[model samples]
Target: MANGTGEPAEYEIYAIRYGTNETRLRGRNFILDARPDDPLTMDFFCWFLRCGDRVIVVDTGMNPVKAKKHGHTMLLDPVATLRDFGVEPERVETVLITHMHYDHTGHLDAFPNARFHMQAEEMAYVTGPWMGRRWFRHAYEVDEICRMVQLLHEGRVDLHGRDRAIADGVSVHWVGGHCAGQEIVRVRTARGWVVLASDALHYYEEYERGIPFAVAFNVSDMIAAHDRIRELADSDDHVVPAHDPRVAAIYPSAGVGFEGRVHRVDLPPRLP
Candidate 1:
C-alpha cells in the first residue's frame, strides 16, 4: 500500500520496554494535586520504527549500569533487546532522539553507523544556561553529551529546527515542555497515523484530563503538546505514551513469551 504522497502507507512500530521502577510517589508524576495515597510509577521504554527500508530508533535507552545506579531496575540491555527483535544496532542508519535526557541518550554509541536526528534547540538548551542549575543538569549525563559532541564532529548529527519529515512516512514535531527540545514522532501505520508521544504525555490520564506532568520545563507547553499529539494521531488509541505501563496491556504482544515486555504498536489496539 502506498500513501497518497507515494510513501509506504504503513510502518511497523514497536514499543520496547527496557527498564522499570515500581516505587510509587505522590505528586511526582502529575502537576495536579491528589490524595496523599495516590500512586505513581513509571516504565522506561525506547521505540523502534520500521518504514520500508528505513529503520529509525527513537531514544537509545539508558545503559544497565547507569540505570541501576539511578535506582531503576534494568530489565534488559536495550541494544541487545533490539537484536532479539531482529534489528542489528550496527546496521541501523537513523536514530531520532526526542530529547537529551539521560534515559533517552545513554546508549548512543551502540548505533555507530547511524546519523542522529535531534532538535537544534534541545542541544542549545542542554549546553546552555539551563544546565547551570543542578535540577536541569541532574536529568542528563555529561558522558552522553560528550559522545553526542563527538558524533557531531564526525558529521553524524542532523539537527532540525522545527517539525519536519525524516523519511517518506515518518515525521517529528518539536514540543518543548518536558524539555526545551522535546519532540514526538508521527508515523503512518496500518491503523493510520500513530504519534509516539515521548514524554509529551507520560500517561493516558495526562492527555485525558489535560494535566501536565510534574517534571516539566513549561507546564503550558506540556499541555499544548498534548493537544498537538491529539491532532496528529488518528485517535486516542493511536497515541502511544512513552512511560505508561498500561500500554503493554492495551496493545497486542509482539511475541508469545515477551508478552508484557514488548508490544506491537503498529497493529490496531485491542479495546477494553
Candidate 2:
C-alpha cells in the first residue's frame, strides 16, 4: 500500500460495535445448513478507516428507533461513537455504505457533509419493482431509503458499478448476494489488506463452512461471494466479518474506554 510518493500509506482500521440481536438460531442464520437449531447472536458494527488525515466510515448503522423496532439492543449511538473516537460527523469526507439494508442505512442523515459511496445497483434495487415484495424488502427501512433518495437528489451520493478506490489505501468491491448492491471493503493496513466482509459474509463460519445467510436475495451469489472476499483480502485471516460477536471478543481493543465494543482491526487478532 503506497501513496503517489511511493511511501507506505497504510491506514488504521477500527471496528465499532453498536448493537446486537440474540434471537437468531442456526436454522434462521444459515440457509444451507441442515443442523439443529442452535442459538446464535448477531452483533452490529460500522468500521472506521484512517490514513494520516483522511477519514472514511463504513455504514451508518441502525438508529435507536429502528433497533427497537427489530428488538436489537443498542449499545452505543454510531454518531456519538465516531465523535468519541475523534471524528466528527460534520467533517467526514466520505462514507462507504455497504448496502441499503435498514440496519446499514438507518442514520445516514447524520453524515450530511460527506459523499456517500454506494453501488448503483443498490440504489436501483431499493427503488425498483423487486422491493414491492415483502421478503426482498424485509431488511430495508423505507424512511432511510427515502433519505438516500433525497441525498442522491442533493448530489451527496456517489454511485458506481463493480468497484472503486475510495482512498489511497482503501477500496470497495461489489459482491451482490445478500442484496442486489451488497459490497465489501478492502483496506490496506500496516499488517495487510483487510477485507471488511460487511453483510456479504456476516459470520466468519459462513464462509469457512461454505454456507449462505438465510436472509439473502440470491443464494448462489452469496455462496460465490466467499471467493470474492478471499480475492480481495491478502489472506483469510485478514478478512473481518461484521456481525460475528467473536470479532469483539478476540480482537484487541482499539484504545482506552472502548474495550469490548471497539477494537483495532489493523492489528493481528489474538487467537487462542
Candidate 3:
C-alpha cells in the first residue's frame, strides 16, 4: 500500500505513465541555473487513488498527438496506461484535475462514470483570461474546456476554488502559481501525510532550490505553492513530485521499469 497507515487496509496509489520525454521548455529564467543538475526529463503520469474498490484519478495524462505538440517527448496512450495498471477507464468514478493544463486534463471522456473536480478559478481563467493572451495560448483544448463547462452545467462537475475535504483522508487545497485555479491533492496515510504536488512542484529541485516551474502564471504564488506543498506534506519526505523521472528510480517498480512504479509513502527513503 502507498500509505503505511496500520489500518487493516491501505490506500493504493498507482503511478500510471501516459508518456515520457525531455523538455527544454521547463528550463526557463534562472530555475535551470539554480538546479544545474536538474534533467529535462518529463514523465507524464495520472495518479490513481484506490481506497477499497473505489478509484479516483488525480490527473488524466493526455492523448499522444496533442501531447507531442505541447513539448512532450513521447506520449503514451492513456487508455493503454490505465489497462496496464489494472484500472478500467469506464469504472473511474471521480477525477480530480489538479489544473487545466493540456497534458493533465486530456483523457476525461475515457472515464465513463467519472465526475470531475476542478477549481472554479481555472474555468474562469481558461474561459475568459487565457483565451485572449498569447502566453496563455494552447494551455488546453478549448473544446475540452467546453466539455468541462458542459459538465458543470449538467451538475456533474464539482468546482472547489477553495480548500476543502473531498473525502475521508483526502482533501483539495487551492495553490495558485502555475495557473489561477491550480490545486494539490493531500491525503492522510497510515505512515503520516502524503501530498501529491501535481505540477505545483514538478520536480524536487523546484523545492530544494526554491526554483519554480517556468510555465507559471504567478512566480511568487508559485514559490508560495512550493512552500505550501511542504506544509501539506507535514514534512519534506512526504511530498511527491509529479513529473520527476527520479520517482521510478527510487520506488520499487511494480512491473517493468516504468510500469507499476508505485511511490509508497510507507517505504524507506529513496532520495538523498
Cα shift from native, residue 133, model 1 (Å):
0.9
On residues 173-248, what C-alpha lDDT tens digit does candidate 1 reach at each position? 9999998999999999877999999989788888988888878888889999988998999998899998888888
Query: Which pairs clash inside model 1?
Result: none
Candidate 2: which stretches are off by over 4 Å? Answer: 1-6
TM-score for model 3?
A: 0.87
* Winning candidate number (TM-score): 2
Q: Supply the TM-score for candidate 2.
A: 0.96
Of 1 and 3, the candidate ranking higher by TM-score = 1
TM-score of each: 0.95, 0.96, 0.87
Model 3, 1-272: lDDT tens per residue? Answer: 32345553445566665577765444442454645555577676668777767667888887666766766754456667667777898888888999888888777788767888988888888888567887875577877888888888877788875797777778899898888888988877666778888888778878888877777788899999877887888688778777777766676555554543444443434666
Task: Report lDDT (Cα) of residue 188, candidate 3.
Answer: 70
RMSD of 1: 2.0
Question: lDDT tens string, model 2, 155-222?
Answer: 99999888998877788898999999999999988899999999998999988888888889998999
Candidate 3 clashes between residue pairs 3 or more apart in a chain or in different chains: 5-190, 5-191, 254-260
Which structure among the candidates has the greatest lDDT? 2
Better of 2 and 3 by lDDT: 2
Task: Write down the lDDT of every candidate, Cα atoms only.
Answer: 0.86, 0.89, 0.74
